[model samples]
Target chain A: EPEVTQTPSHQVTQMGQEVILRCVPISNHLYFYWYRQILGQKVEFLVSFYNNEISEKSEIFDDQFSVERPDGSNFTLKIRSTKLEDSAMYFCASSKKTETQYFGPGTRLLVL
Target chain B: AQRVTQPEKLLSVFKGAPVELKCNYSYSGSPELFWYVQYSRQRLQLLLRHISRESIKGFTADLNKGETSFHLKKPFAQEEDSAMYYCAFRSYNTDKLIFGTGTRLQVFP
Candidate 1:
């Protein structure tokens, strides 16, 4: 089966530095999403994208965070300035329909 | 605020024993419910959705409107059933998934 795939399975970056987490959603899927899970915490929604624009976002998705579908296949989350709290497992998900979403293996990002 | 709760951090069961992972949600309107599972060293994958009402891998979950819960249950679990299970919710119109803290199921042989 086709799966959502992310690049840079793990990343370590200094605080205040910019970081870009890339994801290639399942082919033919229309909606894309980003979620994060802190250690020992629940997974939290960050943002969702459709039609080249963000469809919905949570309060946790602040100015520092931005998502882009730079190409037909790539969905990228850019953190302009990373904070220590930004360290977490970031997951990318995609769906052809609204309800059933497929998730990627996730990118473990560490902002030291 | 919308929330999904998985009260148990860990649930231990011997092989062939029944297993149930409790999940509850606080949503005023009806929301779609889902269960995702992640085995050791693997990515998270969908296990069941209350909407489908189909049993996959011998696991089933019922959406109890009265109790505001969607608990996952399996009659007999195998040692291979050990994994981290997460319960999730999404409003009807949007696609963002709100997830619970998750419960780790250890089915011992």
Candidate 2:
């Protein structure tokens, strides 16, 4: 089965530096989303994208976060300036035409 | 706002015994529910969804709209069933998912 793929399974960065997490969603899927799970915490929604634009975003998705579909296959989340609290497991998910999303393995981000 | 809650952070059961992972949600409207599992050293993946109404790996979950719950149950736990499970809910009007704090299910043989 086709699965969502993410690059840089793990990343370590300085607190003030910028970080970009990349994901290639399942082929032919239309909607894409980003979620994060802090250690020992529930997975929280970040943002959702459709038609190359943001459809919805949670309060946690603040000024530092931005998502882009730079290409037909790549969906990237960019944190302009990272904070220690940004460290978490970031997951990328996609669904065909419905709401049932399939998630990627996730990228573990660590900011020191 | 919609929310999901998995009360038990850890649940232990012996092999051949029954298993139930409790899940509850706070949503006024009807919601679609799902249970996702991640085995040791594996990626989080979908185990089952409420709409399918099918049992998988001897596990099944009934969407109790009346109780605002979607608890996952397995008749006989197997050692291989040890994993982390997450309960998620999303409604038709929303594109994002509300995930509960995961529960680690350990089935000892």
Candidate 3:
């Protein structure tokens, strides 16, 4: 079965530095999403993308966060500046329709 | 606002015993409900969806609009059923999933 794939299984960055988390969703899926989970916390939605544009975003997805589909297969999440709180497991998901999303293994981001 | 609630953090049952993982949701509009499971060292995967109304690995969940719940249940559980299960909700026109804290099911042999 085809599955979503993410690069840099684990990332470490300085508090004020920028970092990009990359994902390649299931090839045929049209909708993509980003979600995060703090250690010991529930998974929280960050943003959703379709047609190369953001469909919806949560309060946590502030100015510091941006998503891009720079290429056909690559969906990337960029954080302009990282903070201690930014450390978490970030997951990328995609679906053919609006339901039944498939998730990647997740990238563990550690902002020092 | 949409929120999913899984009250139980951990549940353990012996092999061949029945299991039930409770899930409740708070959403004004009709929403799609799903159960996702993650085994140790494995990625999250969809176990079942309410719309399908089908059983997967002896598990089934009924969507109760009156109580706003979609609890997952399985009869004659096997030891392989051990994993972390999350109850999720997605509203219309949205691709984002709102997940609950999750329940860790440990099926003892």
In model 1, where do residues sit more than 4 Å from their true spots? Answer: none
Cα miss at A97, model 1 (Å)?
Answer: 2.7
Query: Cα lDDT for residue A94, model 2?
Result: 94
- Please report the candidate that would top DockQ against the real structure: 1
| Top TM-score hit | 1
- Steric clash pairs (candidate 3): none
Give the least accurate 10-residue stretch of model 3 chain B, judged by summed lDDT: B89-98
Between which residue pairs do clashes occur in model 1?
none
Candidates 1 and 2 compared: the better one by DockQ is 1
TM-score of chain A of 1: 0.98
Model 2: colliding residue pairs:
none
Error of 1 at A87 (Å): 0.3
lDDT of 3 by residue, B2-38 (tens): 7899999999999999999999999988889999999
lDDT of 3 at A63: 98
lDDT of 3 at A73: 95
